[model samples]
Target chain A: MSAARVGVVTFPGTLDDQDAARAVRLVGAQAVPLWHADRDLKGVDAVFLPGGFSYGDYLRCGAISRFAPLMEEIVPAAKAGLPVIGTCNGFQILCEAHLLPGALTRNASLHYVCRDQRLRVEQTATAWTNTFAAGQEIVLPVKHGEGRYVADADTLAALEAGDHVVVRYLGGNPNGSLNDIAGIRNEAGNVVGLMPHPEHAVEELVGAPSTDGLGFFTSILKNLVNA
Target chain B: MARVIVDVMLKPEILDPQGQAIARALPRLGFSGVSSVRQGKRFEIELEGAADEAALAEVRKMAETLLANTVIEDYSVRVEG
Candidate 1:
């Protein structure tokens, strides 16, 4: 089977685009670099918006990057069932774009945090998390200042009803995110946004005891193959 | 043109550890009566025309659709001529 083409978008000040691309390569997929200013999708099978302090996190973490030219195209593609994953700042952009509900606020402590976190996969139906069994626990790296997730009572109820909550922090709440949610999926389940940095944890040598982060990239490949 | 000022803040139910930390530090700095501090974002939007009902509606749409999350953050818009 041919390798799936996964595009990793890089906005100005993006910090993890390279790591995301490498993760894709490690998972046997072609990693395509996408520039924020480019409107084209490059015919990639899947897309990942890597973590970063896009636009210097000026107005908000993902605020300025949401207006980037690429989002104009990505937003439509994501709605049409294209698989997209956003990590950390990328998750903020997804929220800013309205592709996903909820917003990431400053860490309850309001201080920048960096740590290895354990997360439980709550749903395995999304394109970016299908490889994991439901309720599986995996360790990945999380680094950010604004990572707390907040949603309205009604929206939170709706998300629970739809089973859209994807991943939750295991053990301790890292940033005081509501419900300890580390990640979530859109109603379509094709788009996912998470606070953790799976790309940075893909290699066991550099990250935790296992290469659990590889599941994210591998999941997308399986989703494309099955589709 | 009309101007719309939108203030966005984290919901009160959620703990504001950052705010508490600052509040704690204030008393130590010898500045009495510094009760509290809550951090948030403020946006100033200039409308296409004078502040009016119609322009305010457009600004509201912008806030709901993009400017604010409306989930954990509450936004209030004030219109001024």
Candidate 2:
């Protein structure tokens, strides 16, 4: 059987599309390049929105990017069960698109935080996290000026009750995200968004802090194959 | 032509670190009378004609849809004459 094709979207000001594609290829999947202006998914099996200051963080981070032509297609496809993973700025975009709940705001410390962050995998049932065991601690790089995750009390409660909190910050809360939330998944488990850069952690030889991020890429491949 | 103003502010419950930083700096700068500071955005939208009720309503729609994120913010619109 042919390998799964994961489309990595590139928006103006996006800096990590190449890294995301590399991770997909490393996991033995075909990495497809997608542009913000494209109106279709190019028939890829999965979609990834990589981290970066898209549109130079205009209006608000991820706010302008959410209205991109490609996102018009991605939103429906994600709703139809197409697996989608968004990291860092991508996570912010997902929230702006309403594909995910909450918003990523300025870090509580009022500083840009760049570090190898520890995350506890809280839900392994999502398409992008199935390779990880629940409660597993993984380390990945997180670099962002605005990465604090926030939601209303009701939304937060719903997320926790539904097991949608995919990952929680371990060690130190890098951005003062509520409940130490590092990531979350949609109700259908097809969409996942996280503040950490998993794609940057897949290559230990390249001085990546850990190879734990490879699990996300591998998990999507397995989900496609199983489908 | 008429100009409409839209002001956006974070919901009271959400923390505003940027505003807090400014507030902290004020005391050091000898502006001790201020109790707090909240930073927000203001947009001036120009229209081809005199501002009317309909124009104000339209600006409100824009504020709701794009000028601000309703999840964590609130916005108000008024005609600037």
Best by TM-score: 2
Model 2 clashing residue pairs (backbone):
none
Best by lDDT: 2
lDDT string, candidate 1, A179-209, tens digits: 8989999988999999998888887677464
List the global CA lDDT of all models: 0.88, 0.94
The sequence of per-residue lDDT tens digits that candidate 1 reaches over residues B1-81 is 667898877677656677788889888988788777876778999777787888888888888766776666668889754
Fnat value of model 1: 0.65
Per-prediction DockQ, in order?
0.53, 0.82
Displacement of the residue A172 alpha carbon in candidate 2, Å: 0.7
Task: Name the runs in model 1 displaced over 4 angstroms.
Answer: A207-209, B1-6, B11-15, B31-36, B43-67, B78-81
- In model 1, state the lDDT of residue A177: 90
Q: Candidate 1: lDDT of A209?
A: 48
Tens digit of per-residue lDDT, candidate 2, span B1-81: 999999999999998999999999999998888889999999999999778888788888889888899999999888874
Report the lDDT tens digits of candidate 2 across residue range A1-227.
98899999999999999999999999899999999998989899999999999999998899999999999999999999999999999999999999999999999999999999988999999999999988999999999999999999999999999999999999999998998999999999999999999999999889999999999999999999999
lDDT (Cα, 0-100) at A31 in candidate 1: 96
